[model samples]
Target: MTQINITRVLKGKYTIMIVLIIGIILYNIMNDENLTFTENIIGRMIYTYSLFRNVVSLTNYEEIEKFRSNDCSIYKNLIFGFSNKNELGIIVEHSIGYGENQEWSILDEYESLEIENIMGNRHWIEIDESGELTDGISMDMNRELHKDEVVVNFIVSKKLLENNNKLKQNLIRPVKCSTKKLCSNLYFDESKVKVVYENDNISTINKDDKAESPGIVIYVHGGGFVFGDMNTYEKVLQKHAIQLGKLNKPSIIVYIGYRKSPKWKYPIPLEDVIASISWIHSNAERLGLNPNKLVVLGDSAGGSLATSSIASCLSIKDQSKRRNNNVLSKRFHNYCKWVDHVKFLGLIYPALCQKCVTNSKLKNYKFGFLTLSSLLWFEKQYQSKYIESYFDWRSQPLLAPANILRKFPKTSIVLMKSDILYDEGRLMYETLLKLKVNAKLRIFSGFHGIYGSSWSSGGSNALEFINSEISEIMNQNN
Candidate 1:
């Protein structure tokens, strides 16, 4: 080759290396708060080397058919430089925010692959090969593209996941089933908290109870996209745990203080329940429980979570990517760790479909905060993140249980007379029965959130009502 041509080639290579190095350095410095300016600069260099290695050394797929032929799922990725079939790690390529890529480089980066939009403009990557990662772009008119954001998700192989000690430990943690009566002054280290994986982690206040004893039902409380915590269900969980203990055949009850919304949504909370169920099983011996003799319960928003969590476990294949022909082989790791088997499922007055229920709720409460607040917020942040189809009831099935009725665990549907969510629970119950899933329908005569209130603080007869159904399920399961 001519000298000029060689010089041009070398320069292009040098430029790519420089940009990668800068990107890595900036990322590290951005994360390091403890570093002085100069120290940060030094740390930046240290960070740049690792980042450079990841970008330059990773696998590349430029051909469309080759990429399409590989096994690819949101949950699988190949390990960098580890050619051995057994040693790949989960690596993801994602661009931030909501929108189509303004930069052409990303198009070139993901060329030849099909992208399928799932929820709210979030697209799933599809390649010819099951798990192929490509450096080229393909034009897919059928796919929905968000305005500025794009992400390619894939889990590393089991071997790679295991080798990364930090990642493995980070994903799973010990469950603490507190026997101590919860009060306003309850102390917990939220930082030290980790998601449980085995049933052994479930602790009950009444651990000495017998095997045939009634099962304690735990509810994971829910708030809209944002709002609520363990405190939301504090009275509900405590009242029943205490009541079950009083029955001598004292049952064990547990509630998840899961990480919450906007920041941690969807998969994070779902994973938390999976971990909690595992913990309940692991601690069954200590907690004097029968793993099979249990009922998982939730109300409203939590019901959606409980149902989704169950669906996540029952399906062996990745339901999210099941439609895409190119994603099967490349998807290595299963996102769900285990199926949470419970004797009964309980959903009381739940906002199962946000699009359906929210519109109705907005109509009646006419003058409230949500309408004005969302409008004001939208006025300020009205960037068309994605010029795509507007979300409606049919578009977002993940938020509703209408699609996942088959294989549903035995369930009891509870609702109050005046609550807005009453219709939803009733509809869901009807659907479950239509699908031939073993389910029961019950209507408690009360207002929304006011089960049978006594004169005591935070008193609600809902606990007594729910416990009765739980006892029947336990008895039947036994």
Candidate 2:
């Protein structure tokens, strides 16, 4: 053979050997069903390298989707990253057999008017001349309706609500401080009060009695619809209350404990939030709360709830205007009385749309501490068989009708650039602006739950942004 031909053959053999080696490495990485620690580490490194290349090349949408759908676990872990061990620990802790092997129950009854009252103006009943409950709807009617529609719409089976009367329980149960003591504590300093409305205990924090009535902030805590309560968020709430008090703004901070999902289904949590708003409106005078200057603030899942609650209020208002019946109109009007009072909405890295979970754009994106798989898992646990039910604005606020979006209050959206929901938050802000709703967007470089760690170096900016928004709202009213 000629010398040149021999060289060509050698080069071809070398190229084939390299390709085979690469193929074997990829096959091992992809085919390992139950990877050892060492194998997992190697797999992660390879996945990360591939992800980096794809991102740098600006991979097309189809290719990204194919990659994500092909290997969900590896894709998720790679995007979630291993740098934040603390975050990884949280994910593992929360994901251990998350939704499986749990007790389930079917809600017994359905009551449209009862549900409506809970969703609308259930707080409006008053003591008549005979000192008896005097609302137009009868208990019998509520019972009959409960057997029908409420069961269909609001019922779900889950471990959290099965044994415990969690629906009526106070969210601050874990605080170790009674209402009176909490009010007197150093953090609260006579600025906190606990009140029960509709069998649900809510915490109200404000300034000293002599201070002027201030704007109201109805705060909803986030736990992915399964874990958070007032006690979990008390310190942050206290800090905001204290800061506002010192400024002489004296805002009434209402922490609502709504029933969570996988325990209570779709409309239940939303209705509970609405009930709290109704309670605030009914007692606005006594609480020294300025109803016209109300701000609804929520983080993560709570942001979704906050947005939906406002949408519900707006819906109730529209319905009330179209109805002529004095009784129904009165109930809806009472429910909607607080709608106009909502002057601002603060969403901190909110899960605005579940559909965003499967969006192709986020397939290669690093979702900070939250992984796409975990988000999907939570969504399944929260909605369960009612996945189709999320099409409405009640579950996904971004899916709200244009008419409703137009009526949304001035919104201040805080998005952590690293969060999976960041794009959705920006989309929501832009959509609000397109609908002519007053809106502002602030993006920070942080993780999903950074807002809760306000004292941490990474979260301080988010905390300050929130404080400034509150200050701006107070100034507007002043």
lDDT of 2 by residue, 101-204 (tens): 11111111121324322232112223479866443434453333222111001111111112223221222122221123212211122212222212122223
lDDT (Cα, tens digit) per residue for candidate 1, span 1-478: 6456643532344534553466455745464332234333333432333232321222322322222222111001110111232222322211112223111111111112233332232222334575552223344422333221211111223332322333323223332433222111221211133232222322233422222423445565554423344323333444455444434233545565443332233433444454455444544443334555666777655666676556644442344246466353211122232244466787766556544544334433111012223322211221121313333221122333444556677887776543455556777787888889898876654434433233211114455667777756655635
- The superposed Cα distance between candidate 2 and the true structure at residue 129, in angstroms, equals 50
- Candidate number achieving the greatest lDDT relative to the actual structure: 2
Clashing pairs in 2: 105-157, 109-146, 110-145, 110-146, 110-147, 110-150, 110-151, 111-145, 111-146
The models' CA-based lDDT, in order, is 0.41, 0.52
**In model 1, which regions exceed 4 Å deviation?**
1-216, 247-249, 286-288, 317-340, 357-403, 451-459
lDDT for position 222 in model 2: 78
Q: Positional deviation of 316 in candidate 1, in angstroms?
A: 3.8
